[model samples]
Target chain A: MSHLKHVAIAGATGAVGVEMLRCLEQRNFPVGQLTLLASARSAGKTVKFKGTDVTIKELKADSFEGVDIALFSAGGGISKEFIPHAVKAGAVVVDNSSAYRMDDSVPLVVPEINAEDVKKHKGIIANPNCTTAITLMALWPLHQAFGVKRLFASSYQAVSGTGAQAIEELERQTREWAKAERKWDDVRLPADQVKVYPHQIAFNALPHVDSFLDSGYTKEEMKMENEGRKIMHHPTLRASVTCVRVPVFRAHSVAVSAEFEKPVTVEAAYEVLRTAKGLDLVDDPTLKKYPLALDVAGKDNCAVGRLRLDCALDNGLAFWVAGDQLLKGAALNAVQIAECLV
Target chain B: MSHLKHVAIAGATGAVGVEMLRCLEQRNFPVGQLTLLASARSAGKTVKFKGTDVTIKELKADSFEGVDIALFSAGGGISKEFIPHAVKAGAVVVDNSSAYRMDDSVPLVVPEINAEDVKKHKGIIANPNCTTAITLMALWPLHQAFGVKRLFASSYQAVSGTGAQAIEELERQTREWAKAERKWDDVRLPADQVKVYPHQIAFNALPHVDSFLDSGYTKEEMKMENEGRKIMHHPTLRASVTCVRVPVFRAHSVAVSAEFEKPVTVEAAYEVLRTAKGLDLVDDPTLKKYPLALDVAGKDNCAVGRLRLDCALDNGLAFWVAGDQLLKGAALNAVQIAECLV
Candidate 1:
């Protein structure tokens, strides 16, 4: 444990970067030194680390020289450009971007599901999509219990997954509506109101999450099918997903109906989830207790509930899963990968 | 059209009641006269009708006198107590509550799916749940072409379905959050801090929409399976639903995977939905267009998109549907029943 390592976090001023700092503090990770790096726009900004202020430096190709670990969440373009440079600097990079997740050379790892996959990483490890990570958190436990064949899933994804700008957009539009209704007198818009999204997201749900692919599925929607196979080591696994952006600020929730090759029961699922790591069971429907975003917003483990047998398909189970998108989806997953390396 | 019937509306100040008024105006329903009724607390309130103010009368056993059509949406307790009275007063009742949906004598109608069921109504007709109605709007069309067998659905329900108060609750909480984060010091909390829900709704997604049942499903979740079978006239038709409450002010979206006896294809679904009344096709993924709550907020027709083959099930097709819960789910459906009678 005393063999601590220095960590450098790219996009240190961004939402996932903030979560990375919190995760390090929460997990008591062996952080010999911390380097906070951001873009030129965020350079010189100070961030608090364990009650001490750390000034952010502009990220460059040479910034990772002394850093043993590099966590990147500054979007795909930034990660694509800087990841190679960091890896060349001899740092093990855990990237929270889709740029390299599907790259054959990069291993996508969800530590709880496939930690051994980390050993195959070619300097850079990819974090699975928030929806994929949250869904697999519940599905993996069941997949181990019953051989999963296919899945039909719909995600109620939080706006935070889109980044900090989208979160501000939701809050800003919601306040605008409230003020317009004469429900309150105070009305103020955020100074930077560049529509990060196509539509106003304050009090609405958008079906188009990310850019649409040639297969007619949004980038976010195809992630479960594409990333799930890689993380679960199931090359032939099938999934159809509808990823939706909801007004939620934090946690992402997924409703899944999984079909397995073998028989599965609600009782068996409950038993499996109870002892599973990175999972919590809040599925007592009779008591009005189930996995909700509000309860799972700040938590590390994904909350799964509403588990029942699917009446429509044989050997199918229907369940609802929720987890903090910023945590399991991005920051915590990257940190967990770093932990595995240590 | 000269024989336009006299109409009465109970729960005239509620969320659905407001939509009922708008739907009647938009569709130009033939009405000899309009009677607005509400509980004692709101009896004297005035609501707009045909650009004129109509006073709300106290709803009682004799309040439906001389009325030929009555639309009830004042919760199940009020509907149960007043529906018989309205029936005895020579009025045909269309209820938007769960009070009589499963009753043997009551006919549940989704005008597009089973308008013929309206003729079977013995004085009272039941409206399907908002989520159930929005789901079937697109499904029934596909079901006709494919001979539907079963469905797995998850609803992204709006706060308005909970009533006017819940909408107010979402607005209030949002404002509270904005004021607390006084980036703009001008924001202040509204004087009336009334709570319509048990929890803060803004920036959060509540998995529990309605009251939980003994069978581990919310009352809202079971509505699809119970009311759907009744409305579809398929006593054995199966549905598994997970109803979620989102922060949208209007329009409920549902992701559905339906399995039919016959083969299903995206092309065939496109054809079925294109010609289907009460459904608008919004499924072009290339343009990043799909059914969204913001787009369907004030629309009568349910917007259907994300059409594809369900990879998990045999003969299964997956799609996403969004519709204004206030309109098709409540107001428009009720008004359509009146149109059928005319």
Candidate 2:
């Protein structure tokens, strides 16, 4: 972990990419040099890393020439088109998109849960979904304690997961609602003026978090099952999830009822979660305290609270977990994977 | 069924009470005469009814005199204090509060599955929890078809359920954020000016919905188990729920994964829900269509979509349900219960 490596981050101007840069600095990652890459539109941009300016380069197949590790936070299409080039250029690629997640050849790594999986990566490792990674931070520790078999989860996903545009939309619409400048009845905004989401997100909940699948579940909803099975190494593990986009700016929160093969008591689950790495126990009902998005917005560790028995399922426990979706879900997880590699 | 009856609505100045007024007009409930009652603060306030002004009378022991039926949407304290008075005045009371919900003598009603439960009410009938009611609107119908035994649900509750002040707070903070009037550090506002909710409701998710109980579950979370048993007539029916308050202004949505005694199929569940009363099936995966808060905000019927089999549970099916929390979760459910009595 002490050996320095030259690293390049694609989509350097994007939200997750920026967070990746901050995470690398905050964690004091051993970086010999940093390369920032973006589309030609952002080629001239400069990002400050370690109090030094790093000019953004136009992302191209040749961009990975001198990079030992390439972290890609760009869209799936961009990763699909360029990740192979990075691998071919002799750089290990860590992709934060769905492009290579389900690929048998690519390992999906969450350092705490499956760091060893990274060793098997064929030059490319896929990052789990933001919501799934945050949830597994708490669930994996409990799974080790209780042998979890299945889970039912509902996510309160923040707008930042949709990118910078959606965050601005929430800010814009909220102001509009507050000023009463736009009554609910006046629906005549121009196309450019219309915000990120299909509807105003100021004071609303949208059930459609991602694209819908043929099975009626959104892609975000299926990620838990698909990615969970891959990460947990449980081919038969079951998951029923509903992903909702809330007005929250950052952090993703999930309420989960996980059924285990063995009986799970709140005390035992608490013991495991309290000491688990990257996890915090916030389950104090007496003080009216628990893990809330505001409390975990910029934190590294995911908070787990509201732990109890699932009254409906035998040997099942219900809990609520919150984590900075940008950190644990994307940037931090990617950096952790890089750390495990070195 | 054709006979009209004089109906009175208590707490006419409240959030749900106003929604009840609109629902009655929207559904065209058979009404011979209408009475609106409120506290002293709202007494003499004029509300429109059938294009005529009806002045609110101060709710008193005698307010229900000659009123054939009464819908109570006031807080528990008011319901506890005046529900008996309304009953003594010869009107059946359909209460939308927890005052009598868990009482052994009271019948917790959801018209579609438990309309018959109304006959068992001892002068007062109780509406289920907003989250429970909305989730069960879809689950109960499927339960009747599949013999449901257990459920795991997470609720995305709206701030409106907290009452009008919280709604105002969400709007206010959003506007404040939009205007950039206050950074996250500016905290000089007076305590009274802080407005509804213990924390800011804009751009945040609060895991605590209602006050917490000794058992660590919120009163809002336990409503599903306590009220669910009575409404479903399955004293042993199990439920594990995590209730959360989002910044949404109107609708309450729930993600439900229910397990039944018999084998459940998405096809069969779809068939049952397609014809279920008080529910609209809005599932269309390829078209990216499904139930959402924005779509169900001002509507009466609960909108259900994103239906599928639980990949995690045998004999389990997962679905998403949303309804105007103020309407079906409170006012409309109470009015429908009153309609059943007449």
lDDT digits (tens) for residues B10-128 of candidate 2: 98988889888887887788888889999899998899978989999988888888888888988899999999988898888888988999998988998988899888878889887
The value of fnat for model 2 is 0.73
Q: TM-scores across all candidates?
A: 0.93, 0.94
lDDT of 1 by residue, A99-155 (tens): 999999999999999999999987999998999999999999899889899888888
User: Which CAPRI quality tier does the interface of model 1 achieve?
Assistant: medium
* DockQ, structure candidate 2: 0.57
**What tens digits encode model 2's per-residue C-alpha lDDT throughout A182-292?**
643232334454557765565666777778776767788889989998998988888889888887888889999998999888999988998999999998876767888
What would the per-residue lDDT of candidate 1 be over residues B1-342, giving only the tens digit for each residue? Answer: 248878889998898998888888878888779999988999888888788988999999999889999999999999989999999978999999999999999899998889998998899999889999999899888878898888888888888899988877776667676667653212223435536654456666677778876555678888888888888877777887888888777789998878899987788889889999999999887766788886787788889998877766679888899998889989899999888988
The TM-score between candidate 2 and the true structure equals: 0.94
Task: Give the residue spans of candidate 2 off by over 4 A.
Answer: A182-200, B1-6, B26-33, B181-195
Q: Chain B TM-score per candidate, please.
A: 0.94, 0.93
User: For all the models shown, what interface RMSD does each have?
Assistant: 4.3, 3.0
Deviation (Å) of A91 in candidate 2: 1.6
